[model samples]
Target: MPLLRSNTADKFIVDRRKPHRNSDVARAVRRSRDRLSQRHGTPVFDRELLKLHAHAIVGSAATIPLLVLIITAAGLLGGMAGDIVVWAFLTMTCYAGLTWVAHRVRKADASRLNTISTKRNLLAGHFISGLGWVYFATLGCVNCQVEQFPIIKAIVLLLAMAATALITSSLRGALLATFALPVAAYAYIGINSWAPIELVMTGLLALSLPFFSYVASHFNRSSVMLLSFRSEKDALIAELETAKSMSDEARRRAEEANMAKSRFLASMSHELRTPLNAILGFSEVMSNEVLGPMQNPTYRDYARDVHDSGQHLLDLINEILDLSRIEAGRYQLNEEPVRLLHIVEECCHLMELKAHNKDLRIIQEFEPELPRLFADERALRQVTLNLLSNAVKFTSTGGEIRVRVGWTAGGGQYVSIKDNGPGIPPDEIPVVLSAFGQGSIAIKSAEQGTGLGLPIVQGLIHMHGGEFELHSKLREGTEAIAIFPASRVMEVLPALPTRKVAAGGRRR
Candidate 1:
């Protein structure tokens, strides 16, 4: 009953089978497990060990019964011990011979039991061997005839039979039969033949069945579980290696793309500037009456438009190249001593006409004791020009623009440009500083701009190791600030040309 209720019994029992494949299910399971181990790159089990186990199952089943017969015969032949000695030795020899054969069978093709084909063979061999054991038990019972022997001896002979069937082959069936028949026969022997020790031994053997079944079930389950876990771990490690490789590839591609973009910008800047210089130069000559004056005022107007549009295009191209160099981290600085106040004055003077045309007032506030700062003159000029131009562009007619230049001790000098024009919207101020990003005002006004000016100003200032700041509110006005480190500011001045205006819009 314990064996019937056991986990292995529950799984391997006839009722648990589907009836159609029940006869061959164990064989199929063994074959499938073996094949799975082979295909999955798992280490294969030793075939020799499996075959040895199989032979041991069959050989032990057969030998157990014969041993019982020999012992019973020995007891019965006691009276004619001397005369039957040779026969007994002959019987013992046959038993040893069969055992030796079983050992040889086990040794043959030991690796074969782990294969799918061999596992089926092993299972079939077990069943057939069990049937052979039943036959052997029948022989012993027939030879020890019931009519000649005492009933007790005959019964003891029958009871000892259960041991001949090795429990390892079909564990479930072996366990049940081992307990049932042995206990019944032993009980009969004890009551009828006064062998209580034999009854106790039989009882003890029956009790051992559940413990062995429990241990065997867990062992099989543990083997399968460990294999499953190891397989999953290996697959996960492989996937991680693949992902790391892809990530490294993506980083390499990003760097290459950035390099290509910088090369394109440098090439485009040169190409565009070449033609633009020729157009502006020709326009300047024409405007100066070098061709004896344009015969028609319309011709002059056309020439002026050409000059202005060409310059505008050139400015856009230059800004794009500047931003490209900054993003690529290839922009270099030329350090020179610069009069901070003078540079601020030059920017105000340049934007004077544009401010007047818009009717906006200009105001300059310079701290008289400002120190000469070390900086890149061309970059500072561009930064100052951008701030002034943006302020003028957004200012309404009759607004005020204020320019301030001063020093912040221990750190740097600051240039502040403030305008009371239609100010930047709070949400869009940061966006306007980004490349190709414009504010709501510029979009609504249909402003003709490439949107690269502010970004270039920020880049130029940062290259000088300075801070560029902005403060604005919608419709109020914007304040643009630049701060440069004092240590980078030059301590000595070199003889430089005085700031000169382009006389009548012509560079001198």
Candidate 2:
């Protein structure tokens, strides 16, 4: 019977061991699934993860001296200084090793940093460093005989543990592992103590765990959100840069096309002008009967019409070529000293016949003794003629066209042409100033034009260091003014004295 009982006891022990082993296996399976889920679901960028590890290691290195001080102040180190020093040395060694790992990770290729093994190593380093704090909790101040030493030591440890959790909060798994072991040991020590104060300290430490966990969770959420925002910002910047590059390429192509058009027009000018000159010359000869008498009176009338039409076409072509040259920066000016009064008078005389045909009067308002202007003579004449022609073309029968030349407010000179015609609408001013753009008023008027006048005027004035302005009101009148800068006005110098010779041919 005794033999039978020994066998039964052995069987019973084997049965009990089976469940324990099975439970261990099950717990490990659950842990593996949790780690896998964490890895797949909440993926952090490799750089941020590495940064978290480096921060934790550096923080641990900095806390070692504080821990030693706490132990020494508790008087726990009086007899255990050698052991404490050894523990401190070991903790620092671990920190230095982890720091070196962090440095290597930081310097490694980006592809290497994202590997699973690299991340695991970082997690392992953090977990081992946590073990050092657990060692401190177990051996550093656990043997203190003084009544208040345990409380002081526990409080310091709890604070340090909370700080560690916060520092490594960007890595959730590492943070949980880091504080769990030390806090558990501290709680166990507090719970089994005989003193009420120690028990209360233990309760407080237990209650504070959830609070620290919440802090870690909060920090983790914030960090994840910030990383997401940063990633999106970088992506947006890349897209904008791509769009800008494409737009620049398109703009370059457009500029090339425009330059090609200008070159084509410039090349065709000679081909177009030669035929127009022939038409004008032959029509003039036929109209005036310079070669022979026309057999029919109707032939003379037809020849005259042909001459006028050819002249108009020639003017249009000239305006177009002049505008193209100006735009191409090839219209060089023969600049000289010119009197504004004389130019204005000449332009008026040229336009007077057209104005009289429409029964309009030309009015002149000249400032007395105005200074001569330094400018392009031909360009100034064109500017004046264009303005007067427009005034005559737009003015109604029995209307008045006023031309003024005067000193401007800032010691500069100005020439203004005003007309009582259908004035330009304010909104159409820019349209009229652009090349080949006509205002509604000009379009509706009986007389029509090529509409290159104002743009040409503006370009010529700009080249001469001057400003051009147009002011008009609806159905009231319009005024076009060209203002020359003070620099372009020739100041009169005092005349040199002429020395009189005493009836002898000698220099004075």
Candidate 3:
């Protein structure tokens, strides 16, 4: 009983990290209640492990005397080693076989079938052990001198009888009623006079039943509490992880919306400027010479001023449109294999006249074997023009601008425009790449611009799956480079099967 009680106490050990729940206090209460219950009922054993210990205690107490009686009755103290050996083997073999069968059946199936199999094994072990007692009884009766064998034989008979009584009890009842048989049997046999005294003693064990029942109830409550605590802890951790994921997704979506708004504004500007350009171009022709300089002098001058203003506005509109298309994800690349070196040459030729006006020199350097690029030809040309124009526009007279074309370390084509003008500060690099952003030099100079050139160039390079890089130090000039993936020049053919139309028949 104390062995069972100690297992119950082990459950009360304190875990220092979790201080709120302590097992020790619960154990103390259980012990106090046990003592009180013992006074009113039978003794309680605290755990299931102690039930086996109880069986061993009962078995040893009953078997030693029975063996002595059998030996005396058979007159075998002098020469009966074989009989002793046989009895020992019989007892051990029966116990082991019953235990093995129980284990195998429990593993093979674990539902009602297993429960039935387990109880059957328990009954069988008891039945086998009882048979050994019965044999000892018969041997004692036959060999004992006088009256000595009766008491011992009677105890063995009581054990045999009760074991027989509950062998076929229903499964649920067998769990509760099995304890009664062994207890009743031993008590009746131990306390019998000419009667079976041990059998009667076993019956008195019924007095302890209520206390055992209370102990069982407490154990069940503790198991339920432990299971529930584990479930709640798991749920709480899962909820926290889900909340963190949702918060991260919301922040990403907000950033995307802001970028979309900037793109929309830029696109509107471009669309508005296209029509304005036609109007301005025709008006300028009429004011100058298309209609012979007009007959009214004042009307001619007004037309000339209007044309100039319209042209300026048209330039601003085009820049805005370029920015919008890039942001909206509506910018399409006209991919084809084209020589990058040729593109650089064209840019230089177009800007040579402007550089000459400022007394600046334009230098061009191209790698001899540079590969062609799969990119939008028109966009690439516009990117080159923007960079070269900025270089020429920023540099003072006699300053030099260099355009270099080469391949990148990552197997891409690179085009860089360098100027001898005042360079941007390191801190202002990101600002200059943004829409409407002016660098330190540009802000200080008298040059007039919409501040959209670098932003537009960066957007165009990104559309081609490339990068735009700028390196500068104040008054040391700046370098802007656009790097593109390499490609091969080939005759145009039907489109390959790369496109996958969405459910709505649109390309995502």
The Cα local distance difference test for each model comes to 0.63, 0.75, 0.61
| Candidate 2 residue-wise lDDT at 146 | 48
TM-score of each: 0.51, 0.81, 0.47
Q: Write the per-residue lDDT of candidate 3 for residues 1-508, one digit (tens) a residue.
A: 3543442322223222323333454454454444333321122212121233223324344343454455444545544445545655565565455445544543442222433344455555545654444344334233424454444444544443333222221122322343444444444445553354434433434444334434444544453344345434545554455555556656555555556566456545557766787878887887877857577888878888889889878777777777777766778888887878998898899998999999999888888966567777899899999999889878888999988998778667789999988888999989988899987778888876788999999899887878899998777899999887543333346554544434335733
Give model 3's TM-score versus the native structure.
0.47
Candidate 1 residue lDDT tens string, 1-508: 3544444432212232222223244444454455445422232532433443445555565565466456546645544343234434544454454445445556666433344554445444444433432322222223443443333433443443334333333222333333344344444544564555545544554455455455544443454455456545655554455555556656655665667677777766778899999999899777776869678888788888889889988877877888899888888888777787898898899999999999988899898967677888888898999899888888888999999988766657899999988888889978899999988788887455778888888888888888899999777889999988777765554555455343534663
Candidates 1 and 2, the one with greater lDDT: 2
Clashes of each: 9, 0, 30
Q: Any idea what lDDT model 3 has?
A: 0.61
lDDT of 1: 0.63
Those runs of model 1 whose alpha carbons end farther than 4 Å from true positions after fitting are: 1-251, 407-410, 489-508
Between candidates 1 and 2, which one is better according to TM-score?
2
After the best TM-score superposition of candidate 1, give how far the Cα of residue 82 lies from its true spot, in angstroms: 36
Candidates arranged by lDDT, highest first = 2, 1, 3
- C-alpha lDDT of residue 37 in model 2: 34
* Model 2, backbone clash pairs (residues 3+ apart or across chains), number: 0
Per-residue lDDT of candidate 2, residues 144-198 (tens digit): 4545755765787677667766776766676656657877887677677667887
